[model samples]
Target: MTKRNTKAKQLILNLLKAAKSALSQDILQAQLGDAVDRVTIYRVLNSFLEDGVVHKIVGDDGKQYFACCKNCSDKKYQHNHFHFRCISCGKIECLPNEVEVKLPKAYRTLNFNGVVSGYCSNC
Candidate 1:
């Protein structure tokens, strides 16, 4: 029972890789119906997070979004990326981890989340 043999996991990984943006469990379940149970999707996502195969972030809407982590390993995401949330369609995209935003000294920062909201190119 090696993890590599799990069909559901492979399906999820492929789905995330093909996605242009992060995906929620709701959306994942919709894309993969009868083949994989809804509960399995959630479990696989959790496992991926723990295994550092994918990264999860809480969106501005307070919902969890999962995206594949090609740049992550050993339980840490080596790159820092931003989330572009489209206000028009409510679609959130994971941008490349290259943009750096300097925070002002006056603002005490605890956690940094670069989530910018605006209309996407498709909109």
Candidate 2:
């Protein structure tokens, strides 16, 4: 993997670290001020995603939101945490549950990927 140094990546990471909720590409670009172009920010996000430095989740609006990894140290990209999508506010919140998911024996026969999302308590 080629390492590239760009302000956009740094800014994006910082924003993700600071944000409490999921962020879309538009919001990230707005928060980045004038430090990076829209295309550059998107590219940076994609690169980080490919490097396993970040994870993307799909919202109810059919838009992808990026969030920092829960197990960033180990570089695990599994969606072990449940996603809470506020029906009223349309915000995707990450619930604070450090649980690991184990698939059933039946699922082992077939390759299974798990994802959990629903209306949050705040809704």
Candidate 3:
């Protein structure tokens, strides 16, 4: 699902990479300041998701958040870290510290999600 390199796609990728946290499509579109149409945004996002360029997460409030993948080609990041959601501001971001989950011996680790919800610094 790789998209041909285009100005719109590059813009979107750069924005996501520089973003401190995940952003909803609405927010992302708004940030674009009408530089791109909604349809193009969706197309690009869908392609990026399929290509492992980004990962989508559903927050506690049921809102979808999208963040850029660090190295999703092999998907090693799929189970590496946790996410933090700000209940007050409704912003979601990846937590810097790794979450520790103790498992029984011989238990194989697979895909998992760890979430920590609270107020962010600004909220």
Clashes of each: 0, 0, 0
Worst 10 residues of 2 by lDDT: 108-117
Local accuracy by lDDT, each model: 0.80, 0.72, 0.81
TM-score of candidate 2 to 2 decimals: 0.73
* Candidate with maximal TM-score: 1
Residue-wise C-alpha lDDT for candidate 2, range 7-67, written one tens digit per residue: 6678889998888888889898888778888898788888877777777877766777888
lDDT per residue for candidate 1 within 4-44, as digits (tens), equals 64999899989999998889998898999888998899999
By TM-score, the candidates rank as 1, 3, 2
Candidate 1 steric clashes: 0
RMSD of each: 3.9, 3.8, 3.2
Q: Model 1 — which ten-residue stretch has the worst lDDT? A: 71-80
lDDT of candidate 2 at residue 66, scale 0 to 100: 81
lDDT leader:
3
- After superposition, the stretches of candidate 1 with alpha carbons farther than 4 Å from their true spots are 1-4, 98-112
lDDT tens digits, residue span 92-114, model 3: 89877666677899986765566
